[model samples]
Target: MAVVEIYDTTLRDGSQGEGISFSAEDKVKIALKLDKMGFHYVEGGWPGSNPKDMAFFQRIKNHRLSHARIAAFGSTRKPGVPVQEDGNIQCILAAGVSVATIFGKSWDLHVTRALGTTLEENLAMIEESVGYLKSRGLTVIYDAEHFFDGFKANAEYALATLKAAVRGGADRLVLCDTNGGSLPEEIAAIIRRVRDDVPVVLGIHCHNDGELAVANTLAAVRAGATHVQGTINGYGERCGNANLCSVIPNLTLKYGHETIPRSSLAQLTDLSRYVSELANLHPNPHQPFVGSSAFAHKGGVHVSAILKDPRTYEHIDPALVGNRRRVLVSELSGLSNLFYKLKELNFNLDASREETRRFLEEIKELEHQGYMFEGAEGSFELLLRRAYDNYREPFKLESLRVIIELKENSPVYSEAIIKLTVGDQVVHTAAEGNGPVNALDNALRKALEVFYPDIRRMQLTDYKVRVLDEKDGTGAVVRVLIETGDGERSWGTVGVSTNIIEASWQALVDSIAYGLLKNNGR
Candidate 1:
């Protein structure tokens, strides 16, 4: 089997994703991460298009890379411009990189409509641009823009365009699915035909518009493509690019191909979540393989069976990808969920099966009252530990009072008066904020600061309130979910009650306790 070189375009293509923007410093951080992961190539960005990317190349030169080569991306010289006079081509050379990748029009329609150039002229541009870079001692990777679509519209023209790149000494012809509409079978067929005719090394670059980018990439690999291009977390314009998070494992485990070394495979989940954090996007819970819930089992039957045999419900061992199995206790669960969760928490609940039955009924009743535990494992853990004889209380809330005052020309203000007992100490504090929730958070933290000053680092990253029954006209039960982060890691805690304020308090208290407990090793 041939080795497939992994090329990442995360810094450039991934920034094109909606709400995804990285500073020059952010690009450097991500570049170091990619290089450390042992990728073959990391395409930094288009130097000619933006100053941030241009700075990345200049700044990245000082650090020595161990594994990956940095590639600069650009388009071929403009339709009628000389390669020497093209500003974009000059930028690529100025970046001082070993590898240079340039995209050129492959589709006849793009040549006639988008570029307003003749087919023969486009071919000349591809040859001239590629030859110019290769002549300058740069390893040129020619991205055949829209190669698959071009093959469908005019197969002869597409093949001719690739042939032009080869004549110009392009090292690799990366077939691009720009419109991202092609399926896997179609991709495989096209790649096979291209290999039969085109003598150069072939590569694959696909978008996820059809939700088949990974599938198409794998299909191309099976058909003999030697290079694959993708972005981490599938971040890019539109539906995003091929997700290396999914493709890398699939190639390594399922296809017996290696992108990164077997040891680096464990870093896949952390890498995925790291990128998600830098992008400031929540990790998709349902994302395959690396998602938080990827190995989570909720149904009692599923969890019970997994304790017997993980392969009964799981396709691959979650630990293989640095993820762990999660048993979620919900209204849909049974005693097995509690047993699994309690054991993980190291709680020896010496209860008979009848007592376990009573506990299950209690959980069902609370869930019916809108207490959701799945997203609030911290709160659930506290509840579980409370059932044991050795469990110790962290702090006890004595009282809380919140006041909302509306002004004539300003926004409403809220103040919270709180009292708490930490061991034998009774503390009282008051704090004001812009909203009721913020005020409550401030008051609680102020009271706890004397005892646990590290609690000051807890930041409420997310808060969500769901109305369980909205028809009750201000008397409905609500569920409040809060996400807290302690500079390094984060967790979710939840509370439900008829009063939104009360529910918010429950989650806020749990968020603080969980942060202290986990970080301080309580």
Candidate 2:
């Protein structure tokens, strides 16, 4: 079996994605993670582009990478300038990398129209650029920009451009589907033809315009390519580049290719989340291998079978990708599903009776009012604890009230007052905020803090509101989900009501109360 090389460009091409920007610190962290994950090459960034890339190179210069070589990406030299004098080429050298990648126009239209250069000059551009990088004692990889479409337009000319790079002593020739419109069969055919003509090793770099970047890359590998280049989370221009989170495992497990170690595959899901959080990008729920909903089952039958044996519903054991199976609870849940959920919460269900049925009915009633327990396992656990007599209310809600006053010449303000009794003491507090929900949350925390001062350390990290019945407008039922973090652990709580403010207040109150209860071991 041939050894497959994984080239990760998450910090470079991935950063090209709109609204995606990574700090130098973030790039270094991600680079370290990818290196530990055993990627063969990590394209740090385009050193010639901006200060961030330059800073990234400077910061990571001294760190010891265990498995991956850090490659600096840039374009070929200008039409008239020598490669030695080109600023882009100089920056690549100054970046102090062992390997450098340069992209040159391969399409005839791009050469004659976009670049305003003749065909022969473009070929010279490729040759001279590669030759200059090699002379600088850097391993050069030539990226044949628009290679697929260029081949379709002018086969001989595109092949000639690649030959120029090979003759100029490029270490590897990377075929790029720049526009990402080529089919899998086209990629395979092109890879075969290119491999036959080039003496140097071949690699693939695919975009995701047609949503087939991963497919085309795999197809190319099957045909002959040895290196697969992609961004970690498919972050790139337009739709994005091929996702390495999906490709690496596919090639290693499905195709039996040797890339990352099998034992390290389990880190895929967590690594994906870690990178997403660092980038401040939300993880795509449907993304293969590492998405939150990748192996989640919500339907009754699906959950039942998954409970018996996960393979019955899962395509791959989620544990293999550092993720666990999640059985979702919703209107689609059945008795068996509810029983399984209760069991997971450490509840022993009465299988011979209708206990699960009663539980399902209660869930349905709560859901009808706007509550969604699926995402608030902490709240659900509390409910189960109460049902099984294992729960104790840490504090009591004596009273909660909202007061709103509006004057014709002034902005409206809302104030919430809460009176709560814990043990023998009663605490009251009033707070003002922009909205009724915010006011209530502030006052509630203020009241709680008199007794449980630790509540002050907890904060609402995220808030999501869903209207259960959209047609009803303001009268529509609303579900509020609140995520809370105390600088150590995070948990979610949910509440539902016809009024959005009420729903938010309920969730916020439950979140804080649950935190106190859990901390106090009640």
Candidate 3:
């Protein structure tokens, strides 16, 4: 089997993205996870840039990594500075990481404009910095920054810079598409030219400005590149880096290369979602392999075909990437789609000709009235069960009141009182929270806890609000979607009302009801 090394720069380049920053603890945790996932190299940030990165080097020393060798990133020696006297070079050596990667100018334009130095001087900087790092016994990876653009503009100078690094004993030469504007064919052509001319192991680092980073990377691998650099969820500056979530699965399943252990491939979905949460960024549902909607079938015809044979609609088995096939029900859903989804909920309703029409009509009517069943499966299941069988209510709401007050010098306070009846007992509870919706959620949970203790375990994970008509301004009817989790799985519920608080409260009630129903029934 061919060995294509996976180099993760999420902790370094990924953090360079706008609205993205990781704490020292976040970096350590992510580094450990990458090591667990068996990446060949994990690049921590430049230690000299910030205290957080410096602290990461000290903090990571406490635990031993299993697979990944941590690498420290830095730039080449300055124009007038000696390798030994340069602050950046000294910091790279001081970093406790096992490997060192230094980026140098490969583009003559950047060399002239950014560095304001002669082309020959840049070559000397690359050679001295790489040689000094290699002399320190650190595995050196020389990143030929903007190699693709430089190769297009002046192929001779770019090749000269790489030759300088090789003369300095750099182990690997990484060609970077820093501008991310190179097409796959252009990348393949340039890399092939470099391979025929240069005699070093090649790697590729791409940006997605052209939306072709993944394609260009695959082209690089196909053109004899042995190492690939990317981030977990493709998180990086500008348009982001090549997505490893897509790259790993494509390599293992499509190209038949074992970049990581085959068994570890199943953890890809979890790893992508985990990093997104830590970064406090909402996961992209449409991302290739690990996204929520990657394997989800929504069209009525597609859902029906998938129900008969998933291969009819799917390209590859979703289970191979730790993703499941989902059939979503909506106005576009046919009767088969509804039946298929009901089966997932463990409900076997008799879908006779007449009954199917009745259920479909009701679903279509609800969808026409601002209800979306695509994300709210719990609500769909409850509605499905009710249509087929005698549905039982776990609790009944009697009354509710919410109060909000703005203090002169203090923060606003929101309070709620809820009265509910469970079996023969009526429970009343009052609670205070940061907002009116939160207060209602607190009071409802408190009242329900007396009857169903498991309600305490359910938490609202996400809340999305959408206004139906912006022309109405404050009087606009808003829809609230609340996602609830029980430490294991998640379900969504939705409500619509002119008052945002009322809509939130309705969704909150449905969330608790669905949670209690599922737990008690189980």
Predicted structure with the largest TM-score when compared to the true one:
1
Two-way TM-score contest, 1 vs 3, winner: 1
- Of candidate 3, the 10-residue stretch with the lowest lDDT total is 344-353
Relative to the unseen true structure, what is the Cα RMSD of model 3?
A: 1.8
In lDDT terms, how accurate is model 2? 0.87
406-438 per-residue lDDT for model 2 (tens digits) = 999998899998888878888888999887887
Model 1 TM-score relative to the real fold: 0.98
Can you write out model 1's per-residue Cα lDDT over 1-522, one digit (the tens) per residue? 568899999999999999999888888888898889899999999999999899999999989999999999999999889999999999999999999999999999999999998999999999999999999999999999999999999999999999999999999999999988999999999999999998899999999999999999999999999899999989999999999999999999888897888888888899888888888899898889999999999999998899789899999998878887899988999788888877787767743577777887888888988899889888887777666535666789898899999879988989999988999989988999889999999999888888888887889999999999889868999999999998888888998989999999999989988888887675
Better of 1 and 3 by lDDT: 1
| Model 3 misplaced regions, further than 4 Å | 405-413
Query: Which wins on lDDT, candidate 2 or candidate 3?
Result: 3
Please report the TM-score between candidate 2 and the true structure: 0.94
What C-alpha lDDT values do all the predictions have?
0.91, 0.87, 0.89
Instruction: List, in order, the clash count of every candidate structure.
Output: 0, 0, 0
